[model samples]
Target: METSQITDLKRILANSLEGIEDPIERSRSDFCFYLENVVHDEGPHALTDYIQLADFHREIADTLMDDKTSFLLVEAFRGSGKSSLASVAWPAYLASLNPSLRFALISKTDDQAITQLTGIEAILRSAEHQRIFGDLVPHRQYYNFRAPWSEQEKVIVRPKFSRFPTFLAAGVESSLVVGKRFDCLVADDVIDLTSSFSPTTRNRIKHWFYQVLLPTRDQRWSKVVVIGTPWVADDLYDSIAKEMAGKSFFKHIRIPAIQTEQTDHGPIYKSAWPEVFPLTNLNRIKSEGHFAFQNQYMLERYDVTQSILKKEWLKLIQQDYIPKELTILQGIDPNAGRVTGKTGDMLALATVGIDADRQAYLLDLVYIKGDIQEQLLHITDHITRWNPKDIASEIEATQAHFKNYLEAKLKETLGLDITIRGITSKNVPKPIRLRAMFDAFIAGKVLVAAHVNWETGDLEPLPSLLPFVEEWISYSANAPHDDALDAVDIALSSVLEYGGRLAALTIPSEAIIIKDRENLEKEEEMSEEDLELADLLEKYEKNMTGTSVLANPSRFFQRRINFRGLNL
Candidate 1:
């Protein structure tokens, strides 16, 4: 942890010094150097801007310079300066250097594209900008400046001495320059909120993009660059990603707000800009607002309408306690794979215990994929280790093999006889079954036994248990992984008679503790003498060490008290 902190500090110091090192020369050469030193977009001596973003800007600059570049998709967070850096500084700098780089700036609406173009014009007019570009900078003599923001004022100053290309801004609905071809097409804010959420609007934007925008690309000069905050998982950006997956010219950079660090135990997500987005601040945002955090910062999307389980409904048991007098049950979802690989799904199994209050406390869960024999070996190991009182499995043709194999293995190797009851889990669809399980959670009938330590952002010492909560938080109808949810549903069956099977049967009398079911109600009605007698019995029980008690030496006094209670 100390090494990590020191490394972060060194990086910060290095970025702060980046501007000071040959500022004039580097500013002319590097995009990041120019932004930090000349324009001071982060304010005077901010010292600690997110320099992590600079590498991506450098990538864009390099790609623009390369001859073979075809497409670049950049998904960054809300305040990462995707527009200010790429849309403004990059184009102005490139135009100043060569002046022949024709560029078309675009957005979801005409007004937005104009806004980006205006930023470029404003930069071109800056004192430092004019000094650097000198005769090359755009001037009043080059093009007509118009009132407010419009298509007429959209193009940057035309090539003054050279027959090179210039910059133009247009909405997705607008046409590119009629007789002119754009060498580089840069798009920002391509999808608005309303259009992103509605299928009809997204489709409209898709149709408009192919019809109007694709034609603007000059296949010979530079690649198309689209930069924006991704609102939906399956938005237009996803379509491009799919089409470009196998192509050689396609490249994209997805910068998330929080970056995950892998630890020996598990992975922990820390803010990329901890100064601006500390974990405390992010935790509050995540706890109070789910969808916003996910869409804005995480660059992931979920249709909440299709969700059966709400993350906030999950309950965690405190005080590090599991109910002593409860029934233990197990549920299994076998993957029946030949190997542990990314190609196929895995096995999901869960153990649950039901208390007197009918609350189901999730005890343990296992999700893994491997060879069929290897998986059976894994399950056999779990059975020997857990020794759960009752086990449940869905009666599917695929699962029957797993069920028989598990039973057969346990008896053959471990010499333990276990029942594999046919648990019919497919009577309801997955969503419906998951919803049924979610109902139990929402009704406060389900609790997880996790240690109370949200400071480190998890229930430590219960490393195996933390993924259950994370799975709940990231669960969606179109989720890529369903092993966790399936396991949870199987565990929840311990509360219902799903498929003619009891959630859990009574524990045998020999295994039962606190056998008296009506003792609590009887306490209030019992007479003083009867209560005194019960008190003596409780004391005697407390004195026992194991099944035997060494004389308490104060037993004579206890015997006298017992005698007094008998006389009463």
Candidate 2:
């Protein structure tokens, strides 16, 4: 339909097709050869530098040239040459190689398929391509480019090769289930956060691939190549994991932003991929290696033995003595009132404190039941007894009645000012701070109190707590409700925001040391030293200094204390 297509046809009419029966076949084959060898040849780039991943393009060209392998599974980032090499140029060149190569270029949808074909079709129709390629192939259904390559000058250009090298954008489906037939099946950008997480949508894509795509691939050289940035584990990642189990027809190649190398120095040495990634100033691959390592380079699917959070890190935090000070922060599940009665999750109130050296000490937990008012009263009583500096409460979607009642009661009964800050979140639907906390835990940077129960005692509630955290770590951008894990959510959020300081229920007696045992025994005796210290405390409190600077000894001055004490 465009001028480029017309020019391509005219140029082919002028060029001489080296003896072939089908005009289409001769036309396609020559055009393919020209584009690969001359037009878009990525030559002279060093192989070691990832910049020359044009090797991947050349590899695809060779695979398309052969009749043996039809399926391909490619994993690369956005600029890793997926569209230019795989979708547009590759498929178009394949069709040009043999006009009769009845190939289907599929996409996430029909629209995407058409969209992919547009650029390639334009190139073919362009005057430069026509003059250089020497022939114009008719565009078929906005997908196929038909030409007569094997005949004389006057004959109608017809395809000589069989229908093949089809491009299909498949979601998540395995051929074992669906029965489709094709020479080649290429799936690009299959699953995203918006599509794969939905039960209905995911199932529908599964059916489409199994029932429609696989059954279509019934050829001697049948093959499937999947390519895309992995958004989650459910779609293609799950399939790849399953296929890895026994014998697999699929050959996998994972190319993260950073090329991997091994060295005795640090465990993972940097590889040569940086050469290619570094050339682009907008997003240097080397600079973003850490992000790529977490999001793409390492597969987070089945690395079970390496729990992100090491258990040993939690073991060092054992508090043998009664917590001298404690602060309880309660996170009520946003949906506490919408209970179905079958299974009701409660508001988890976990009390944490700072020891003499600013190390976080977990004291206890109160799992409460009942309506908002009842929970509010319990929280109030707990706070009064502890006299914490402040209760870090999550205000997002909290029950209005409970919040209002608590605030009013605090002002009226205790005359205490309660600060409740809502955790900010966007509509994009992902847990942010919770994931960061998990990362800290996994990296062995966080210490949990050793006194905390892990089995059935105080730690009993935590087994239930861990799965949700794991789910948060393993989740995609737009996931379902995390309302049930409100306690951990609030705690992690507050710690991240407020720099790990929590208000205690009572002035922790342990932080204050009496001058001596005799001073403790003396009744109503106010020494000058005590009065001076008391005056200093009054002045500090009046200045609104919320921090306990001298309150912490040892490693407290630093952002975090090295509580492990070199025991590791």
Candidate 3:
């Protein structure tokens, strides 16, 4: 604030750097002290109470310097100050210690690497840098003394007094210049979400890392450090982690958002910096959903271990269980978005039966895309075969229109009378509905056959299994083609009526009925047309799980890709 205070602060800073002549030794002795006392305001971090910062990032530096750990992988949360600490300050500090230490810093792109190196070079040129670490110019004339120093973005500070590089920055794909070996490789932001999304790009980047980047390191004594947060479960970091865990050469350090503890003041949860991330903010983050908080802050895979609708959580039934007091229902999510292929919705419907014990089994699934006549034929075939007590369809604007059309078509063509009720909600989102599908599965109330690929009755289930289980295994928030999944969710939600809670625990459950045609006809008073339609369906009910029908979007794309590649 005043001249006197500034002088006193400088005096204190000088005193703090007292016996630390070598920068590497200083960083080793106290990284936080060096950052606060010497290289102030030069790093990316604005706030510098680095007590917890040291807990997370200092181990990375210590491992790189000591040479005990050859590979250091740090999966830090966003806004955790890892960039400033790992890529910028720590490398600069290491350079001052080993002026002959050849350092290579890389990012996702060459421009990014250059920009980060530029910041590091600026830090080295600061007044405090000159005062504590000494000026770039060693002799009388400043320009002449500094003539040997190269300040380009690609490479910074080729030692005038020595023969090693301060740091060489490049993109992952870029080639390292000849005539030198880099002993330290600091890869920052190497694999971001965008770059890691494509399988081709992901493979290319990983191939570069193994084939190209690894060769640039000095074979004698090189140490690598990866600095970034985890995005997906199988990103670059995860791949390295798979190979390097518990090995003698590599080490990993992960810092979570907050830690809950019990004290004299009762149970309390607090982040490393409450000013940066308060409890209320964390609750808001959690409200974004399970995977959002876990992936970003906790460096986890959005509950891949035990997500809602997991395979292990589901109860399976191989044999048919026809019982009384049954609530036979069908959830119809008819193609609201044009059934016109390439950019349209597939008609996804699920026929489920809940018994007296509340153990619901998926009887059949109808997933297809066709014209209005074909759609009516396919849907009516399932209704005739299954004889579900009630049918629930999402009453969105377009779907209501489709439902009206479906009713008119059924009455006209088949002379069959049917009513498909509308299921409505105000502001409920898709993910919420998807999440709500989990409660019943987790409660062990839902069941599926080993083979749900084809639309078949319980008595004569098809063995041509194109397992839907695989879809659940790979599904995440970013997955495509969720038509069949949405239909199943609607069906479960309707019967369970769990109100998004565990239905078995909270509410009295509904029962399912498996009615034959004779009983169904008597109950609903089927006319002559209905009986004719039933006979036609019974005669023609083959396995309708054709590849061209209502399958997942991913399945369709995959089939297309495979078809194009086939030589036969």
lDDT of each: 0.63, 0.46, 0.63
Task: Tell me each candidate's RMSD, in Å, in order.
Answer: 18.8, 14.8, 17.3
Tens digit of per-residue lDDT, candidate 2, span 1-568: 8999999987897575535456334445543444443344234652222213445555555554555444456666556666666666665555444433333455565456556566466555645456645464544543234332221111112444332222333223433223333555556666665565455676777667656766776555555666666644566546654555344454455555544556777556343245444435323332223223455543333222223333332313324333564433444333335233333345555455544433344444445556656666666676766655445444444344445556677888778777655444543233333544444333323334333331211222244344444444444444343443445555555453434532222222222222232344465765555445444544443464554424532112121122222221
lDDT, residue 557, model 3: 20
| lDDT tens digits, residue span 201-294, model 3 | 7788888887778787888888888988887656788888997898999888887787668999898777855666787877666543444466
lDDT of 1 by residue, 1-568 (tens): 6999999999999988875756556667776666655454555544444234455556666765555657878887777677887777777887777666777888877788878887787677776677677544434642434212244343444444323247677777675545557777788888855566666678877777666677766766666888888876567787777768867888778877788989999999877567667878776665434455666778875453454345556655532345687677788877744432325566877877776655577778777766777777767777767777678876565667667777887888888888877677554445535654654554445666655342222233245655666667667656667776677676666556422232222232111212232333356675666456556544554554232112432222223332453532
Report the lDDT of model 2 for residue 285.
Answer: 31
Output the better candidate (1/3) by lDDT: 1
Query: Quick one: ranking by TM-score, best first?
Result: 3, 2, 1
Q: Which stretches of candidate 1 lie over 4 Å from their true place?
A: 1-25, 42-66, 135-165, 176-180, 303-308, 311-568
Question: Best candidate, lDDT-wise?
Answer: 1
Per-prediction TM-score:
0.50, 0.51, 0.51
Model 2 alpha-carbon drift over 4 Å, by segment: 1-61, 64-66, 109-114, 126-132, 135-182, 194-204, 218-222, 229-234, 240-250, 263-268, 278-293, 302-343, 348-374, 378-568
Rank the models by lDDT, top first: 1, 3, 2
Residue 301's lDDT within candidate 2 is 32
